[model samples]
Target: MYARDVRERVDAGRWPDVAAVPEASTARTAITRRVLRHALGRLPLLVRFPDGTRLGLGGPLVDVHDPVAFHRRIGRSGLIGFGESYLAGEWDAPDLVAALTVLASRAAELVPAPLQRLRGLWAPRHPEAQRGTPDGARENIGAHYDLSNELFALFLDETLTYSSAVFRSLPASWERMAPAQRHKIDRLLDLARVGAGTRVLEIGTGWGELALRAAARGAHVTSLTLSAEQRTLALERVAEAGLADRVSVELCDYREATGTYDAVLSVEMIEAVGAEFWPAYFEAVDARLAPGGRAALQAITMPHDRLRASRDTFTWIQKYVFPGGLIPSTQAIESVTASRTSLRLTRRDGYGAHYAETLRLWRERFTDRAAHVGALGFDATFRRLWTFYLAYSEAGFRSGYLDVQQYLFTKDAARTDGAPRETATSTTARDTTTAAAEGETAP
Candidate 1:
C-alpha cells in the first residue's frame, strides 16, 4: 500500500520532498542508488498487492538519507545495521517485521550481502559476537547485558532471573507477571531439588539470582559467567545477602567447567552459545552433575510456524544484539540433547505470556531509567538502538514468533516419570495468557 501510494504520487509528478531532483545532488543520488541497490539487490523477493501488482525493492530504503552511512551499516553490521539504522532514523518502514520476514526467507539466495560481508573479512573482526574473533567471552556479554543492572532490577521481579519465568501461577498484572516470576523461581528450585547442604551449579548465572536464592535455601552454589561486570555485581549481591560464603561466582566458560553437583540449572543462556556448541554445553552439564542429579534448562523457543525470518530481521539480531544467537525450533533442541545424554525430557513447559510480561516489564523499567541510560554516554542514536531492541522484543513475543520454554532434564532421578505438578494458584495468572497464547500460536 505504501509503495503503491509513492508510485502514484511519483507518476503524477508530485514526488516526496526527499525525492525532488534538486533535493538530491549528484553525489547524493549516486550514493542513494548505490546503497539502496546494494542492500536490496542481494535479495530477490517481492510483496504482492491486493490488485495483483507486485512491489518489491530488495532491501528497504525507507528513511535512510545518508548514503555513506547506509553503505556502512549493511556492509558492516548486515541485518543489525538495518534495524539500528531504522531506530537511528536512517530509514523507515510501515511494517518493520513484515518487511524483515520477506527478506529473511530469501537471504540464502542473496549474493551482494555475501560479497559485502567478504569485504570486511580481512579487517580485524569487530569485537562483536557471532562473526568476530573472541575478545574473551565477557566483551559481548558486557556490551549488551551489563548495560544497566539497576534498569533490569527496576522491572525484573525481586529475583532478577532475566529469563522467561514459568507462570505456574499467573498474576493479576499479567502485564508484568511479577507474581508469576516468583513462582518461576520456586519452580526452578523445585526442579533442581537442592536441599540444605546440597551443592549446585548454575550456568549463565545472570545477576546471581538463582544461586543466591538457592544459597538462601541452605544449598551451596557455584555460579559461572563470562561477564566481568556481572561477576562484580553478583559478588556484591552475594555479599550483601550474606551468601558469599556459600555462593561463589566464577568466570569460566561453560565448556571448561568442572566439579560435580547435586543439581544443575541454566537459565536463558543457551541461545548465546550457538547451535554448534549445544552438544558440548549439554556434555559439560552432564559431566558436572553427580549421579541422580537433575538440571533445569530455560530458554526462548521459536514457534513451529515461524519457519524463517526476513533478511532484515535475521541480519539485525545476528549483527547487533546477540551475535551467533540462534533461536532454533523446538525439534532442534530436543534432537541435540537426546542424541548424547541419557537425560529424558521430564517436563516441557512454554509460556509465551510470561515472556510478553517479561518484555513489558523490561521496557517499562528501561523507560523509567531513560535519563540514567542517557548518562551512560550513549548518544540519542544509541538510545534509539536500545529502545528499538526493547520494543521489537516485545513485538516478537506479542506476535507469537518467539516463546519462553523451561525443559527439565534429569540425569538419574528415581522419580523421572512424573508429570509437572499443578498448583491451585496457577490459574490466577492471566496476563501472558491472552497475548502470548494468541500471538505465539500465530505465524
Candidate 2:
C-alpha cells in the first residue's frame, strides 16, 4: 500500500519516496535513537510520541507519528533525513517556526563535543556537480528561481522582490511589505550614489524591480540574471513601465557580465556563489567597477565559526532548497574584499529581525494560499517542503543564528567626478520626478 501511494505521488508530479526508510532497527539506528533521545532531553523543547512518551523539558512541541521511521531516517542521513521525515509524514510540529527556533537557538550545543570534533566523518560533503562554475551556476539558478514565476508570485508581494525587506517598524503588515522593499532598494541606491545619468550594473535582477527603480532615478541600468524565466518576466515588466529604453535585462551570468559601470548593486545573491569561488566573485565585482565607482550588496550572513564548521557540509537546505548555496559571514566578506579586490567595505547595516518578520509574512501568505498553490500543480509533499524551508529560515533569523546586511563598498577613493551625494530627500525627489514619466506611482 505504501509503495502504491508513492507511485501515485510520483505520477502526479509530487515528491516521490525515492529511498526506503529502514524498517528494522540496527546497531546504527539504536545509537541514533539514543543520541537523539539524549540531545532532545537537554533542549527546552517537547518531542512527543504517539504512544504518549515524550522528550525534552517542554517548550514548543514536535509530534513524532512514526517514531521508528523518524529514528531510522535520522540514523541514515542526519539533518537531511530530519527534513525528509517531515515530508514523509513521520513527524509534525504544531508551530513549526517556534519549534525550529528552539532548535536553532541551541544549534551549537546540540551534539556532544566529542562527536562535534568528528563532523567531517559524519556530515555529507557538497556534490561536485553542484559547484558554482559557469555552467553549474546556470543549472543551479534554474533549479530554484526558474521553478515557476507564478509559484513565486503567489507568495511574494506585487513588487516580486525575493530578498529581505528593510522594514520601518516591527510586526510589519502586508500593506507595508512592498513599500519596505522599495525602501531597501532606495537605501542601496543611495549608498551607491545612484542618480541621474549614472550607469548602473545590477547583478541578480529579481524581476527587474531594482532596475526599474534605478531607471526611474534617470540612471541607465543593465541587469544580469542566470534565470531565463526571470529575464523574460523582467523584460516584460521593464517594457510595461515604459522604461525599456533605460533598462536592459539580460539573461547572463555575473562572471560573463561586460562593461564597467558607475554603480553596481547585488541583493542576497552571494549566497549562491560557492565558497571556492568567493575570491573570484569578489574579483569579478572589482573588475567591473569603473574608477571611483561604488558597489552595494545585501547579503544573508551567519557567524564566522558556524560558516567554517558547515562550509563543507551539505545540509537539508543545500539538498532540497538551494543547491550550491552557502551564506557567507560578514568576516568572510571583509576578508575576501581585502585580499582579492580594491573595494573597501565602507558602511554596513544589519537587520536580521526585519528578515524574521519578512519570512513570517511570506510563510503566512504561502500557507493561506496553499489551495491555490495545489491548484497550480504542486502536491501536498511539495507544499510541505516549502513550508519547512520558509519556517526553517524564519527560525534561523528569529534565533539570531542568521542575519542579513546591506554593505557598501567604495573603490580606492570616493567619487572624484563631483557627483552630488545622494540623500533620502534626493531619492524621494527622483522618485516623484520620474513617476509621471513612467506612467506609474513611485515604488
Candidate 3:
C-alpha cells in the first residue's frame, strides 16, 4: 500500500468534481487544518509527520507518510477523500481500530460547520446504476455479493451467512464461531414461528442457510435473491443438505415475488435496499404475507439524526463495499411501517456488541487466509481495502455508534372489539431482554 503506487487499481475512479485545484489549494489546506485540529482536540489522536512534527491530542498515534498528499485529498473531497488517503497509504495508525473509534465517536462533528454545509460540492451522489429498481437490484447485488463463491468461502464460516451473527459469547475465537451463526438462524426461525405446516418466504437468502434451518423445522420455504452467484451455490447447498424438496432458491427480485406466505424473514437485507424504496420493500413484504402472518427481520441501525444527515452522502462503504447501501435509523423504520404499511413492530432485540465480535472473528479469519485470498485473484490493495472496511465496521459497533436488531412485525388487524391489535399507548410492563457479559442469543 505504497503512497499512490496503486492509485488507478485501488481508486474506483474519482467523481467529476474531484479534480486538481492548485489555485485554491492553500485555502483548502487551511480549512482542512482547522477542522482536523478541532476534531483531534476532542479525541486522543496524535498525527505525526516526516518532519518529526506531530499534532492532535495524544493517544493512538497516526503516522502520516505524506502530509501534503493526505491534507490535499481531504481538502479536495472531504470525507470520501479521507478514506482514499488510507488506500493511498498517506497515513496509518499504530492501533487502527482505536484510532478510528475515536474518529467515529466524533463523526457527527468532524468537519467544521461551515464546510459541512457545503458538502454537496464534494460528496458524490449515489450512482443511478446502483439505485434499487428491480434491474438495478440485480446489478448492485452482483457487484459485491457475486464477487466469487470461492472468494467468500475463503473467509466466511461453513454457514456462509453474510449478515451479522448473534453470538453466544463475546471474544469468540475464529474457529469456534460457527455455532453462533447457527444459533442466529435458529432464533430467527423461532421469532417468525416457522412450523411443520408453515410456508415461509425468505428475502435475500445468503447461501440458503436460513431456508435450510427453516426447512429443518418442517416449513416449506421459497427464498429469493438477486445474485446469480448466490442462487447457484445456495441451490446446491440445499441439495447437499438433502433439503431440496423443502427449499426453493430463485434468482428473483423481492418486488416481483408473488404468492402469500405464512412467515416472511429478511436478515440485514434492508440496508442494501435504498432508503427511497423502503416503503415499497415493506409493502412487497406486506403484500406477500398471508392474513395473520408474521414477519421478522434483522437490521443494522444508526442514530436518527445521523441517518438523516448522511442518507444522501456517497460513502466509502457504498462505493467499495456494498454499493448503494444505507443503514436506516430505528425511528425511520418505525415511522415507515406506522404510516405506510399495515405492519406493526411488536418486538425488538438489539445485540450490536455481538456484531463487533463477529467482525473481529471474520477479520482474523480473512487475514489468516490471505494466501488463499490472493489465489482467488484479489490483489494486496484489495485486501487492504477490505481489511479496513471490516475493521472500520467493527469499530463503529464497538464504540456504540451502530447497532443490529431483530424485529418481529405482525399485520395490524383490529380485534373483534374494533380496537387496534396493540395500542401505541400500551403500558411498559413487558420484560426487558438483556445481553450476557458477552452478547447473548435471543430466546
Which candidate has the top score in lDDT? 2
* lDDT of candidate 1 over 181-249, digit per residue (tens): 656666777766777998989998798878877898999998998877778888998999988889989
At residue 264, candidate 1 shows an lDDT of 91
Considering only N, C-alpha and C atoms within 3 Å, which residue pairs clash in candidate 3?
A: none
Candidate structures ordered by TM-score, highest first: 3, 2, 1
Listed per candidate, the RMSD to the true structure in angstroms reads 10.5, 6.6, 3.4
For each candidate in turn, the TM-score is: 0.67, 0.90, 0.91
**Residue 332 lDDT (model 2):** 86
Q: Cα RMSD for candidate 2?
A: 6.6
Q: lDDT tens digits, residues 90-187, model 3? A: 77886888888888878888876776687777677888888988888888899999999998888889899887877666667766677888888888
Regions of candidate 1 where Cα sits further than 4 Å from its true position:
1-78, 91-136, 148-158, 167-178, 303-314, 412-443
Q: How many clashes in candidate 1?
A: 23
Off by over 4 Å in 3: 1-24, 415-443
Q: Where does candidate 3 have its weakest 10-residue lDDT segment?
A: 424-433
Ranking the candidates on lDDT from highest down gives 2, 3, 1
Estimate the overall C-alpha local distance difference test score of candidate 1: 0.60
Off by over 4 Å in 2: 1-19, 22-25, 413-443
State each model's CA lDDT, in order: 0.60, 0.84, 0.79
